[model samples]
Target: MTESTAPETGTPSGATGNRKPTPNGTTPEPVDTSATETSAAEPTAAATTADGASVETGEAGTAAATTPPRKRAARSPRTTTSRARSTANPSNETPAPDAAGEPSASAEQPGSVSIPQARHAAPDEVDSAAPADVEDAPGDTVDGDEVGSAATPVQGGGGVVDDGAERPVVLRLTDVVKTFPGVRALDGVQLEVRAGEVHCLLGQNGAGKSTLIKVLSGAHQPDSGVVEWLGEQVRFANPQAANKAGIATIYQELDLVDDLSIGENAFLGHEPKVAGFVKRGTINRRTREILTRLGHGEIAPNRMVRTLPAAGKQVVSMARALSHEARLIIMDEPSAVLAHDEVENLFRIIRELTAQGIAVIYISHRLEEIREIGDRVTVLKDGRTTAASLPARTTPTRDLVSRMTGRSIEYVFPTRVNAPTEPEELLRVEGLGRAGEFDDISLTVGKGEIVGIAGLVGSGRSELLETIFGARQPEQGRIYVKGKALRPGAVGAAVRAGLGMAPEERKAQALLLGEPIYRNMTLSTFSKIAKFGFTDTGKEREEAMKVADQLELRPRDVRRPVRTLSGGNQQKVVVGRWLLGDTDLLLLDEPTRGVDVGARAELYQVIHALAAQGVGVLLVSSEVPEVLGLSDRVLVMREGRMVRHARAEELDEETVLDLVMAGSLMEGAPA
Candidate 1:
């Protein structure tokens, strides 16, 4: 299921769903035009019948209406009545009479309506938006000259745009400003999205991308500046209002109801009804249709959402958006939870959505994805627009990195120090096996040496780390610290052996959110500070303050609750706990998972300093770059097996991805 590596024109050919590639390497041509083929068929516009009831066609508007007219149905609460008519079918011809000399049922009742596919316009005819003399809003000013001045919209890839016409602008923000009590989350942010295009939003974790998305999704109101949707200024009062206004957002942490069925979750807020009673048959049928278009027809509508896999959950989220007839969907870290092959499927679905004239604002940290699926780019830094509407494909990596970090450093790893000729083996694992999780895991970490593991979420990366730390019992094999065997399933034994672990879910697994940072830092070594059955708070704070200074934790306040600290500082406290314990070996799982770019650099130095002091480090991270850049040796895992082992300098990102996704490629294709 890997995308073609061969070059093609327009957007990447791998992004073109339901299209057949010609052998000559020319632009691919659409081969399937059936209604079920979402990328190839045009979305049908709803027509008002004589009785004033609206009717929508099945896929591509090919189905003949069969349902008879009943009582007038109440409008769906989640959808607005006023819609901008699609230019795709400007002239709606009346249905012809049947053999009985009467008009078809479609002439009497209309079905559900979807936002029409956008019509592409010539570049010269496109409006660049606002005159240069327009004054900026207060607090900050968006550089008007950079707005759409450098962007030449990529063409001939997203559905109807293959003819070289540029899609119309659907969402625009100019000098948008949003502020919290103590932080300015958004300052003079500028962004523009066009119908039938994927606009990528790039930034570091704390760079205000989340706040901007909340503003666009109507979860928060902008303090100043303007937001225009479909050529008119609008401020959505709440999330529901934005949903009704053809906007939807899918966050990284999914909002799906676990107990509900697939069909129920898809239509939870706005169920089709008559006489105040929901139509269960209608909900099931409509949901099935949407799933089929997404290339997952085998998924039963009655299946419980909790039973589905991560990729399945993502598809259901997209189905929910289409159910709302959303014209613009904001996806925050959509691919973060997906496996390699599943990501290809997601790109395919996105191609179909853009083909149907839906605008998408995709937010992700992976820079490689921007080149694969994005048409235009907008970079945000420090709550302000650093650059707006740049070409996603041709922009240099150095330029994008400099924009997001305000510096030239990328991957930001501290220089690796060479080990002694005969390194001291600090820890070792001998064929450790955990049934149903991981098997035959064998590795070693030497004094002052760093080893890294690269894998997907379910590839047993976290499980292996936890098992080594004695948090889980292994069914077979053995673990050793300094050539001594460790007792299986014993946390106390592992700790006494000088093994320290910083888990992946630090908030849920590592930190005591309600307690003071000093208390948490002293958790592993409280016995040393306690005298005569009474704890010494003064000594505890003194010990915590020393590590805080070394790690350069923000505010350096040991007495403040850990929850009050930012994500980066909270992680520092977890690492600091081990430091106070005088641990010889450290195991880190996703150490930089939520830390921002600036704080990440600081944490890297802390880790390097620890290794320089003769501590052995073994780390696991989903990001291949992090694994390779920060370690001397790398191991690739897939489906509970160690597939490849090599030095960090011998492996690249693509090679590691291939090793992790080997078995996934042979899985059955969607539908």
Candidate 2:
């Protein structure tokens, strides 16, 4: 598990002697203006004074510090001099300044002030204050002019203050502007990151976080703006160029070769070579080392990446970054596929990287993670920097959320008004078991009901859905559709029995990536598309047009390739295909996995409309809130057994978490 320290609240001891007397007769010597100026200039110095060990900058700036050259860890702290250098040189590769501005003799004593050790705790257990401190440390020593005059104290907590000593700026963006066909994705945006800091970019799906990263990583070139590296201005022509320049990016859907071994995937296209042949032994050794740094030392490098758990695959992605000697890492929604424990592991790796003078840029939708891991924050609204930089310590999660959604977010999951009706059981399974996957899974879906199945990754949620869909036949179960027995392992039989499934993997198993929208939409309902044994292309287009209009597919182009559409729109196409089949029972696994928030809201509406139409919907999702919010009833599963079934209204996140942690919900089963 990743360990994080708490945010310090007491006034810094270094500023004690610098305080002056107030007009009200109170002595206030703790506000040292001279020290701030001196410290601000020496951004890369590691100064340990009689008062405390004060590293001036955050992680982004720490790259300039004179640390031993070694593999980087995510959460390492920075020194005072490092912070000063970062502020001075906002570019990508600017080097550290000379020793003249380094730590003074008086501040180098070990017995002067004792520095606090960072606490090791789980991501959830780490106090919110820790993340806040990380965010505040960066701009604490900036000139008064740079500090926004209209700053307000964040509510629900005491304000966070920088100690003005030990913080690093891990990443900095200046006047970054990017333009799309008809929209400016990013406009003169400036962002800064500190080492050992989790800096969050808060914005709605299209608020330009992805665009900004794309520009930084060289996937998209900005129309205007200079990207600075370390302390020097630099531009990348492509992702490979940025990667070679020491920037590694992990996207929402990982870019890993599933067919390759973990070691091969970790070193894809850059495998170690001795002479003319690929050096498998060298690659495996390096892979093991990188995985060890990520705190997963036990996973064999020779194992196929596809066979690993989803969270494990994510770790492998990180390992790939480490293999490239990445100094600046950008992670987009890394937690989307991770469980509670895996997230903790990711945090640990972040801390370790920072310790080694590496910087990280983390983008995620989980506001709680922002509050837990973020050191600083940048809020983007409509492609503009609404909030240039906010100290994570002092910023409220609600305010950050407001900036992202353009409105106050009281709850993530909107409450559902209706309950499941007991009209009749639409589908039933008894002792459903798949060898080496899950066993003894039995559940029922009622007519017009939304039943949610919840479990951790590798706990058989997707497998169970597959079994019912006939993609994978259960070895020892009886499936009854409307009280009629059905043969196993026959997808045609299941489809004929009024059952339809949207598989977990939408890109590979669900949609025909190369096919046009109209054809892909009609592919599932070929029977309906035929007239007198001849396929009716005209009728198919009509049907496709109707569903496309209903789902708000962009451009209204039925002939466009499914791959050409955005993730959300493509998902709509997939779902529309199953819906067009007129199947009575719908099994959806991770229906909205890759779709953005706006599209997710649209999907919710569709789901409600489906339930209103009396189609039994079995919704399976890894995101707990999605499962809870959309379902009429939720069935908790663990180790392949049905643990508990509860009405959605009677359950909350905490209760669901408890059931997940307990591994079985049989004790809390609804009476």
Q: Using lDDT as the measure, which candidate wins?
A: 1
Superposed by TM-score, candidate 1 places the C-alpha of residue 428 at a distance from the truth, in angstroms, of 1.5
Report, for every candidate in turn, its global Cα lDDT versus the true structure.
0.66, 0.61
Clashing pairs in 1: 54-110, 55-110, 55-111, 56-111, 156-162
Model 1, C-alpha of 377: deviation from truth (Å): 1.9
**Model 2 agreement with the true structure over 290-366: per-residue lDDT tens digits:** 77777788999999988988788888877877776676788877776676677776776676665555567877655
Q: lDDT by residue for model 1 over 1-671, one digit each (tens)?
A: 11111111112212335222222223222111121111112334545333222233334234212322111111111211111100000000111110111111223122233443332222332222221222432211132222332233233223324322335666767677787765676776677788767888877655677668767776677888766565445576666667756788877667788899998888787877778788889888888988887778789988999999888998888888777777898887777657666777788888777766677898866666776677677876667665666556556555555566544443344577664334699988888888888878888888988889988888788999999888999998888899999887887899999999999888789988778999999998998889887999999999999999989876588998776665567788999999999799999998876564545766788888888899999999877778888888888888887877778899877677777765342221110
- TM-score per prediction, in order, is 0.75, 0.70
